[model samples]
Target: MRVPDWIDETRISYDAVAGSYADMLRGRLAEEPFQRGILGLFAELVRGGGPVADVGCGSGRITGFLAGVGLEVFGIDLSPVMVEVARRDLPGLRFEVGSMTALDLADGSLGGVLAWFSLIHVPDGEVPGVLAEFRRVLRPGGVVLIGFHAGAGVRHLTEGYGGHPMNVYVHRRSAAQVAGWLGEAGFTVEGELVHRPDPKTEGAFVFARR
Candidate 1:
């Protein structure tokens, strides 16, 4: 299959900074109480349903967190280096190199899918297909939690962690817009939360059920 230019760029960019990115974000859950709480809620909701996949799981940080909360969880990332770092840093959990657009799972297999700040790299045109893939893998009443930078437009990153030169675009979308996409992908909007996580950017969290 031919890889998309953006996916290739994102994979390379993250591979270049995999170790540094892991180090930088290792303790993020400790600082973000709201995010942690939301994750806990997700875990609670999907606990007994079945296994969960953390799509675009970077370094397995959130994957580990979900497991710590008692959910049967695994992780998948586009960058092989990121998967290596995740396996090395977080043992006893499953981490694989894969793409969100083409998950290697059976139909109606997963109970939940978590796209934590990962979909920000996907373009608007591809969002629907990706969400449809999520829906296809999830059983009836399965849930999906998406975290993203809330707003419009894109941010280009020239330099990333450890001063690594990167060619990546961070695409931001509104909660309502993402909710609409989720609905189109056969999901029911459970709730959407928009908050200012920092002075420069607002964050959006959308919970949907398939």
Candidate 2:
């Protein structure tokens, strides 16, 4: 298969910053009570159903958290360097280099899917396909929890994660828009959470079920 240029760009960008990115974001999740509550709810929803896949799980932060919450979880990321960091940091967990656009998993095999702020880099035209891939891998009634930047339009990021040069487009979207996409992709929109961590940026979490 011919990989998209954006995917290659995203992979390269994240690979360049994997270590710094991991270091910067480490322990940040502990400060977000709401987000932790959300993850807890997701874990409760998928408990005992099957293993969970944390797609685009950079450095396995959420993957490790999910495991702590008592869910059988593994991580997949597009950047090999990120995957390496994840494995190095959390050697007991499973971390693989992969993409959400084409998950390397069997059909109806997952209890849940977590795309935590990971889908923001995916272009709009490709989101539906990615959601479909999520739906394809999930068992009936399996859940999906997606977190993204909440707003309008796209932001082209040139440098980030400890001042490393990057080539990635971050698409900001609304909860309603994401829920509609989930609906169109055969998921039942279960919950929506909008949060403003700072005055300039808004983030959203959309929970749905297949």
Candidate 3:
């Protein structure tokens, strides 16, 4: 599918299930390995007291956590409903409805960017452009940590979890492929972490500095 259509479909799919997803995955989604990866990501990419945007920031958990760590945080999700729920749930933080392929943030404006599971919905053929947009939004030396499933092939999804319809895609790439894309995205690969997020999910956490 073309990227625009893919993104539109993703937005529609997530809008349908935002509330239920937030509730169902609240405490359940934040596991030890995920936490560990985020912490490691923090050490490698983000430090403190600066601007950051979490693309596909569903529920705003990581965004809020990063804010608590003292970085100025902003989150963007494709689903308006998800953005609304995030705003309602975390009034202290800011949330916007938007596409990851394009952000309203200024060029070379951010300190770091986090895209955990955000790229899963992106078509493999269109990921380079997404990565380029990510690079465009970041400062010259800024960093971005993108986490995605580690494996092979593609997954075109149409389902729902917790009363929310799921429009997801899974594109598993090797470390070398990831590194190559990171470099092409104007980022330098600093580190990587690979672990099974669950029985069904094995993920690679790639830390790249712009």
Candidate 4:
């Protein structure tokens, strides 16, 4: 399949900052009580469902956390460098280079899919297709946990993590808009959590079932 220019840009940008991004975010879960709690809830929802896939899993921090919580989990990232970092950092877990828009998993193969702050890289026009892919890879009653910045519009970053020069777009979406998209993609919205982590960004978590 032909990859989009933005996807290529995201992969290259992340590869350039993989190590620094890992270093900055590796222990971040410890500081966010709400996010950790949500992950715990997600693990419980899909505990006996089947194996889970952490899509767009950068450096595997969340993947490792999910594994530590006793859910069978693996990770996939768009950036090969990020996948390498994740593999090196979390040797016990599995990590691979892949895309969320076109996952390489069999239909109805996954019990749950986690997109923690990862879907923000996907442009608005392509978000539905990505959600459809999520629905396709999930079994009946499978759950999907999506974390994103809540609001509207996109922000361009010229430099990120450790002051590295990079090209990336951070898309902020409303919770209601995301819920509608999930519904359109054949997912039943279960619950949503919204919190203002900072003045500049609102964190949103949507839990849905297939």
Tens digits of per-residue lDDT for model 1 on 1-210? 899999999999999999999999898789989888889888888889999999999899999999888899999999999999999988899999999999999999999999999999999899999999999999998999999999998989989898998999998899999999998888999999987877887999999999
Cα lDDT tens digits, model 4, 17-74, are: 9999999997888999988999999999999999999999999999999999999999
Say which candidate scores most in TM-score.
Answer: 2
TM-score for all models, in order of appearance: 0.98, 0.98, 0.90, 0.98
> In terms of TM-score, which candidate is stronger, 2 or 3?
2
lDDT of 3 by residue, 134-153 (tens): 89988877888888778789
The window of 10 residues in a row where model 1 has the poorest summed lDDT is: 194-203
Per-residue alpha-carbon lDDT of model 2 for 10-122, expressed as tens digits? 99999999999999999999999988998999999999999999999999999999999899999999999999999999999999999999999999999999999999999
Q: Which pairs clash in the backbone of model 1?
A: none
Error of model 1, residue 153, in angstroms: 0.9
lDDT of 4: 0.94
Ranking by lDDT: 2, 4, 1, 3
Over all chains combined, what TM-score does candidate 3 have? 0.90
Candidate 1, residue 25: Cα displacement in angstroms equals 1.0
Q: Could you tell me the C-alpha RMSD of candidate 2 in Å?
A: 0.7
Lowest lDDT 10-residue stretch of candidate 3: 41-50
Angstrom error of the Cα, residue 79, model 2: value is: 0.4
TM-score preference between candidates 2 and 4, better one: 2
